[model samples]
Target: MFKSKEVEIPLRRSELISPTGIGALTTNSDGINLMPGALDMWFDNADIMENEFEIYEERLSKIFNVESFRLPPDYRAPFNKYQQAEKNLNIRIPMVRFPNWYYCSSCKTMSKEVSSRKDSILTCSHCKNNYARLIQVPLIVACEKGHLDDFPWNEWVHESLGPRCKGPLKLISTGGATLSSMKVKCTSCSGERSLRGLTTKDSEHLYDHLSKEGYYKCTGRKPWFGDRIQNEECSCIPQPILKNASNAYFSEVLNAIYLPPNRDAKIQKILDLLALPNIMENIELLKKTAPIPLIGTVLKTNFTSLSDIDNALLEDGIAKIINSEDKTENNENAVLLNLKIEEYDLLASNEKIESDFLVVQPEYDKDGNTLLHQKYGISKINLIPKLRETRVLYGFSRLNPPLPLSTNRKEIIENGKSKLFIKPQKFKWLPAYKVQGEGIYIEFDDNLLSEWESSIRNSSRVSKLNERLNNARQEGIGIKADVSPRYVMLHTLAHLFIQEIVLSCGYSSSSLKERIYVGPKENENMNGFLIYTSSGDSEGTMGGLVRLGEISSIESILEKAISKANWCSSDPVCNEIGMDFGQGRDFLNGAACHNCAYVSEISCEELNKYLDRGFVNIYDATDDFKSFFNYVETR
Candidate 1:
């Protein structure tokens, strides 16, 4: 028997695209494991869906080939009984029951039951006249192809005894430490099996043993879609995994910093309106007529209040200017790089841009010195008081980090490279959320960085790290950037800076994230990184982080960071091993470990890879010239 009740689970808006996105599981306060329902099940009313939840990002919209993005519909409660107008607007993100199998400790009976979104309680009918509470089974099965299903309990217990034999199942556990002590039995015929070897390497042995007997296989179940949807056909082998395993879901989120369209307020508004779907085409078609009055008419029809339409009409060739400015590169990587280059150009210019994307160089100290440390080549520091970052949940994977099947969006969705939506054919908008925060941007002297990189470009240590990176890429480990001495130096410095600044910035290291921008090649030469607060709270907007950009505080922090990098608790072992055999995931890190150079994975763009403290300061006499800040004496 099942009981229905409405339950509220509090979730932050940013969490919807991470840790608990679509297809990811979260346990509610009542201990009911729930998975957020598919995008198709989000909202019921069409008007509320379109007008209230749309988010606009021109670069992301063009890259993803979608009209717009949508924020997860937030639930609003009606204030009073007379507030009938607000009642219909209240919306909630739908959830579905997962791992539907439940066991009753009081009755010793195992049952499988599917419940609706509103049902939060289930009881065992065999015990105390249906008063015994049912506990959800924590075991489930998934395949690399992103299919999830309840564990095959019946087949494992019977194991060729008889599929026709219908019997009630009992899950029993003997007091022991290993999984072999837990067994499932058919109460009618006494057929039984233990749950041993189900968690071995890749669960290959268990899959082989059961699959050979024609019992355990993938059913291609997508339970996130509600109960009526049929399972798709799939032939991949399924492996038993715990419901809360870390590899259960890996979200593929894309983030972009907002770049203003124009400096003029009205011009920016007109460009934003033009970025909407089919508006540019309408303008082009209307251009054949009177051009000014006709364009003003179209703009007035599309926008709610365009009092500046006359000004837009008076401008010469506005449509042509907008079109030329709106063009983006066809290649996806090129688009992303061009977008970053634009940001780099703005941040590195040292000019104060005072719009939504606000950035200003910190004033020089009382001594009229802008340079914090000449020996370390610290060239410029800028403070961002206001910035908007948009993050979109595009797709997710089950057993691995989501990889693209092809560059083509349609092909990537169709081949199941990543599960974009329940029925991807209907996917027009992705779920996204935005954050308003502040940051500190630090840029290095290009000439100094080039000179240091050239001094050790062909050294043995540098060659070994590059070789490992190339190997990792060949094995499809997804190392996106090419490793260089300059990149490693910048990356390590960013980590040290984050670790040091958290002590005085009033924000924890977890709330501060690093965005490294290092391009050593001639065509795309850049040397800088941004440390920003991404929490979207009062702490993120406070001026504590930006105030540290002052010359006195920055110089003190840099000295401490370099001093801290000179020695690690792991010492010689951490610094020496990677040069010979390698360290960290896929041997991607050198001279770095959790105790020294690692930060929260959310803070690091490279997942804490490609780091080496030796790049920052001299740890040994033999590596003197290799250090970027070799002029600094050892402690």
Candidate 2:
């Protein structure tokens, strides 16, 4: 079914499974059966990460949220010069290569690793059963260093034998609750061992052994690179991990809202004209010789002469065209992080401002009557007349969450990329897409946010989030310590607002996306969130969201969202729960459940975590310091 889905998916819809959800679904116990309309596709990590530099961690990989289109049809394909041009350009989705090992469910027999796919069912060699049901093995062992492999059943069963032995093995389970009840036995040596304490809470106790060795050492198994390590030996110990474990894999995707260098329409026209490979090569010659016949044909304009165009403007446009070859040329990380600040600067400028890739207009007249600031403590509301976003997925981690790109993550990502590729050279470029759309950006009052966060109740709330972060760190997940009370508040507010705006925004709750911006300190100073819609369609989202940015409409939405968060269907129990003890092991949420604050999974960037209605609205009647919106409600 996965193979068939790969063939049936169209070019535009290839994004449905390009970067994530490749190995997520399938028919049970039938690794190679057709389920009619099922679609299974994935992109090559090496291919996705390949570019002028092998710095997959630094650039050329991320999750692109495409909302509207700015470039022409032919220019939309970012991997135009790739060797696998047909796959990247026409279909856009590539077939996922699943593991070859499969197990028979009924007979409890296993088959050797397989490569051929002509038949869906294979006869069990041990049981001599034909058409036996086989499912892909869901167990994989991995280390924090990013090495992954199959479970070492033979090693555990025949502990007496050395690692090199090829002993026959059988899996046995007594239908018990704990893993100790499940046993693995070597038919050859007649040695057997229970799987007790094998799934240890800490990585230090990877394997439980009766002998003096205490725990089993990692064999440096890397299934992704075939069954061997070619160049170097791994230093990290491998831990047995279930393939379905949440910590097994975490995709690291980077996303940036497209920012243009300038907003001159004529210059933009010149840049688009030069994007055509045919015309770009001859741009230098065209710039020198104005009034060229070829320039008029390429532009297809009524205007006669290029002599009227300013020479300085022409040079500026030429530089932009050259830089467009790879937008990640100048400090890619800065390009990624600074775009928002650039956007903020632009919004603070004159109204009706237009740039090459973006435009902004205030929702109300200059200093017009608006209650967003007076009633809701919202500082400003700016309408995004147009925006472009680009996304890509470069590398991923398993068994432990990845550290941020700012930390030691660079070394981890580089090592991971080296494991995935044979020669590890840069390819032409990575896949990318651009979209155009309009939305609203709401900035909260900094002084008010500072005042609210300084309260003792808020300090305790932040500690709860830090506890989760510490737990992840102790588990070797390497998650960043960026979650503060401000982040949680903004994240929760965005979720509740998305829920309230769905009816009026004329888009499904899933179509609307939230981007939360909060700085680490007051000097870095950012406090705001944006709710917008993106799509491959031409007109974007029918302008419903932008219309709702009107002062009156926004005030109503904020009031309703805050009021609704006061009581969920699961309240009392939800409201009374302790901040440091509840679901998700670390209590990342409070008074927030699917009944009230939660929305579609696609609508949230944090997987719907790190939210609590207690931060936004009153949880208990007499609670003084819990809710920030109580300030507005009392007024």
Candidate 3:
């Protein structure tokens, strides 16, 4: 038996695809568990259909094979001054009640309910005065396959009794900090069971410690899809988890930096026209009839006008498309590498691009010398005044992160393996949001990096790390990319640099994001990283980050970052543990810890894995040659 009510929680448009996205749990001011409904539910609103929330990123569109993306509709209050307020459109992301079990604070009466009205507070009817408020049960059940459901309170309390016994349940706490002190009781039969070992993971089967019969199994319940959507068939054994635990939901987000088209103006326009959903879907028919001329005709039909020059551009664009389709299909790793190469070429050139992507060298005083290159062997520095980043919420996993289906790094995104829409036939676009900001791009000298890598690649310390990374990959852990000494050095430096930038720049460490580019292949050889402001507000675009890219400021920033990496507050212990046994998640880190080289999860692209400050700092007197910046002291 359940009741229904409505509750409204405010969230930013960016948060809709992340922390509070579909299948993820969030709580409101009144401590009610709410989950955003599926994409199908968001589209049911009439206001969303009438308005334009479509976002276009050409590179990402081709990568994900989607025509476009839709941004979450921002809800405006009726009294707001915006245009949507006047119409009282009431556009909001739909949410469903989750962890349906709730308990009365005074009477300890447990009941289940749904959300359907504005006033969603549940009062205890069992209490004599009927004045007690109901609090949501903090525990829920989840499986690795991403199924979520309420804990089996009814079955647990009546474990000693048969399944036929039906009774009201009560959750009582005997005033202790452990789960053994909490017990669920059946009021009618007096049958009860302590919650001991309910959340433990030592058993071979999940929740097997609770009962020897192994009665618990996932119901395939997807609460975010609403009541009408039926539960899917699932055989995964569900495990008990706190409602707000970190392992509950791992959002698989695909991020891409906006790259301006590197083609002729008219040709780019033709390419854009070809990318339209209607045109792309019907490409095969057009190619069968007449590849170039028919495509030009279709473009004219959709875009309304085409001159002789436009027709010529259309012919070239269509020719390139046909050629690409005829070539052997490249895997996800190759596609991702090509995309990075394009960005690397543009940034390394230090030219000022005039589109959404803009990068220019910082101005310096006449007396200011190139200390960064002269002392640290750094090659180039570019200040990006305007940049756009597109983030798409493709899919998610529970218990463990979504793993790649193949050996290819980043292959989880290939073939729509992690697509957001469960039923592909119903939706064509993924949810995405674009943030505009400024950044500082730094590239190391290729020759210097190559020499250093070759010198240290065979060392025992570096080999140990490589073996651990390969083993993790073989075991199907989520360490997607192969770790080279170059990648580790760059990644460690990126973390330390962001930590120092937070002290000088106005933005916090979490507000800045790192994008590391280190390709092991010959043609795709890259050695650079971009530290950008990823905040969704004005704080990110206030020139604080870009200003640090200047010659006067960058030198001090790098010096402090490298100098700090030489020592950690956790010192001998941190370095010793990393050298002998590694540290961090899955022992993926070496000579790095929270005291020194760790940043916020959002800031690190690799989830803070494959980091070793020893590659950057001279941690040992005998291993001075291993440090990339060992020459810093002499300079």
lDDT measured at residue 626 in model 3 versus the true structure, 0 to 100: 63
- Candidate 1, residue 489: the lDDT equals 89
What C-alpha lDDT values do all the predictions have?
Answer: 0.74, 0.55, 0.75
Give the per-residue lDDT of model 1 (tens digit) for 155-232: 777665236556688777788855667888888989888887676675434456653456456888988877888888
TM-score, one value per model:
0.83, 0.68, 0.84
**Per-residue lDDT of 175-213 in model 2, one digit per residue for the tens?**
975566767666667777777666677422445453344
For residue 149, model 2's alpha carbon misses the true position, in angstroms, by 0.9
Clashes of each: 0, 14, 5
Q: Order of all candidates by lDDT, from best down to worst?
A: 3, 1, 2
The Cα error of candidate 1 at residue 381, in Å, is 0.9
Candidate structures ordered by TM-score, highest first: 3, 1, 2
The parts of candidate 3 lying over 4 Å away from their true place are 1-6, 47-51, 79-88, 115-118, 160-162, 177-180, 203-207, 261-327, 364-370, 404-419, 520-524, 536-540, 621-625, 631-635
Point out the higher-scoring one by lDDT: 2 or 3. 3
